[model samples]
Target: MNATHTTFAQDNGLRNIPAVDDFSGMINHPNPLIRESSPLLGFTVRVKTLLDPPEDKKLIDLIEQDIRHILLRLEAERYEPGILISWSYFFCTFIDEMVMARPWGIECWAQHTLLVRFHSETWGGEKCYQLINRLLLEPSRYHDLLEFIHLCLCLGFQGRYRMTAQYQEERERILRLIHQKLQSVRAQQPAERTALLSNTVIHVGSTERERRYRLHGLLSVKKIAWMMAFIALAGFLLFNWQLHIQTENIIDRLDVLLP
Candidate 1:
């Protein structure tokens, strides 16, 4: 959690932002508690970046292949495939590595290329690890934030992250732009509307097993009552049969004594 800030002006091809006073000083992995774990390196790989894409693709591809392979291996142990296939911020470091290491490396490349699309775009390099940690520290709807960040990275790279508002009032403005674009598109196109509505409905619908689970409890109550009633009736019939057998035995004994 150790951090120090130093300011920077745009020099060469670098963006106008702060730089780490000393990256090595800021990053302390040699702490007595820390281990030389590759997963930790994998975590570092997410926040770490190269100056350019072409030169770095080789390493990036290796990281992605590792992530994908691990994901597949984990999949066999899990009942749900989408859990590993989907997103979570806790694994952002791993995810970031996977994205960069993939064939397209679209997500990683976009973070470098598309950050300008958002209002609080900071190209803080590995220092971004601290920033992401800060933003996601508290308990909140983090999955949504991850989705938003993912969208920002992709859109920003495409140069679609535009300055639609005055400084400091920018994020809300971009959201409005997004909504407007979708609204207009939906209004103009029927196919898009149908697809959107269908997807929404499908998402809302309950799964068959969930429906069966809910119904099973109610069905069990009736079954228990029926079983209890049958047991009571059998007990009543057995009592009468035992009484009649005793009476017949007594009558035979009395006849034999009178004879």
Candidate 2:
């Protein structure tokens, strides 16, 4: 293994970490099936294992380390686009699992968001955006729609390109669609309605975070303006106080001259 890979393995706890070097060696193995299946099977199994126990810190660290390594390899042209896509799906599956499990925590949500952004960058912006939009709008996949919306908002707010006007328009349209759907389902059944409302709340929270991110620059500007105003006021008060002292001194001098 290379120095970089060795460092990553060490950081993540090497006990169960997949040795990418071993897989690299198998690229030229005589058995065609082993050569073809080794990497994909190994990668899939490692990722799936990370999802078990759901709250395993070591597994989470290992998965994150692996994700960074994969992205680095992709950027360096060491991996094919197909391999990147497979990894993207694996990450998406993990997100879906989290969503299905009730009471999703912030750490898992953050990890999934990072994976989504990485996938978007590696898969090409337009393709990933389209995939997310399709998933968000699909009625059959409503259970996972909130996560998809969060992904879109993440892209719009933090992506290198930012979201275009067209993307923003589409996002608003989808939000409205979801709202309408939620309303229609409200009177049908209590359990279903409650679930949809919860998802909507989660989606709204993400949108609010995006809104805050967008406003960050404006907020900083306002803060600077307030500080400048405060300083100007303080300077004005100091000048007036000095002028008052000078006037009192002149009056005393005049009184002394009259005496």
Candidate 3:
């Protein structure tokens, strides 16, 4: 994180697209989950240069070893959540890069790697204290984590949540939950929390957040406008019902008189 990387564009967890020309920044961890993930450094270069059959085998093997080691430490709760998150982001980014580079045919290189383990199952479940701890307790950094999670989904880091109808439905459920959470938080701590958490728009596979400013913008409308709109809707329904009743009555009378 000490690495000075420029952020071109960002919204919530969506991070700046750091130029991968220099793999140094991506590899530098403040406190690496393991001793050194430096062996994984060759990833950026290989992804950029060559994705040959032999090279694919080596890349797959190295990433798998490092990930397995990290997952073991995670189970032991040996690393801090922040450090774990940094490594999680790195792993997610690795998958994103692989998707862009597409190494082995149509299937993603992630399923072949340990991305599924780190992203889902191995972390245990929703109750896991290691990663979800920071997420629940630290409201300030919620966007940061959510952004990376969204990025993973966007770039196809399918783990327990595969790229299917279920995957997208889960994504929406998370988005909806965050909106409700922020709304509650904002109401309770309007002054302090509003600026910290705000908006994240959705576009194909993007993590939706902040339901737009227009929801809060409702405060700007005139009371009379609301009253008029309500009255108009009521009046229309009332007239339609009255007209139907009148027609039914007339039809009955005509039938009776004819009979």
Candidate 4:
């Protein structure tokens, strides 16, 4: 099945959904867009986060062209356009929170700037994950999966490996085995591996990315706050200036009438 199947939400196991209050594990991992979201409490992956926002002309126009089709399938309302910005920030971040904000392990695999959209469903929460498991074992997508898995390990995402002490040995064993498989594949296709690995290089703190951009989009909150403050201050000054001028004219009129 393709990534946008309607039945995807129904097949998800119980463990896939996280408790709404507990933002631990992948769920709590750095969101790159938390600074931009006004997420409502008690909902799965969203709310005022969507309900309404100041309309940004640039963002709204971009959504009309690119994102409106892929999200919020049931209602005509697409999510708030401000949270969804130039990096395809809103949609990608939405997907991340829904998938990563988890008490559960991501059982499978998976955009933006130029996102690949499928019209069948708004891939969010359970439905988003359902798409992942459906495509988990497919070889074409597996490469992308491994690419993501590599980054997740580097980012300290432990998933089910940290869920139990019994899984500890299994974790090490799985690591070694996967490493072995990678070696075998690399040995067989060194050139292909090299080309793929060399395609993108991201500097992630002490580590880096050997794949396409995943979690790199971040908007500086300090700068945003400062910019907003400056704008408000300027508007206040302008309003005061106008008010002062009006007051002075009123005083002049009163003096002329009294004389």
lDDT values, one for every candidate: 0.34, 0.42, 0.43, 0.35
Clashes of 3: 1
lDDT of 2 by residue, 149-201 (tens): 33234323222123355465565554455444434444243442333333112
Q: lDDT tens digits, residues 122-239, model 1?
A: 3323433343344344213232233223233322211111223243234334334433343333334433222321111111102232222110111234575898999999999999
Off by over 4 Å in 3: 1-3, 6-158, 190-192, 200-259
Q: What is the total number of backbone clashes in candidate 2? A: 0
lDDT of 3 by residue, 171-255 (tens): 4555455444544544455343343232221112323432221113112135747888999999999999999999999999999
Model 4 clash tally, residue pairs: 4
62-139 per-residue lDDT for model 4 (tens digits): 333423432333122233442233223224424334333343312221222112342323333333223334433442
- lDDT of predicted model 1: 0.34
C-alpha RMSD for every candidate: 23.5, 20.9, 11.2, 23.8
For lDDT, candidate 1 versus 3, the one ahead is 3
TM-score of 2: 0.29
Number of the top TM-score candidate: 3
lDDT: the better of candidates 2 and 4? 2
Score residue 250 of candidate 4 by CA lDDT. Answer: 97
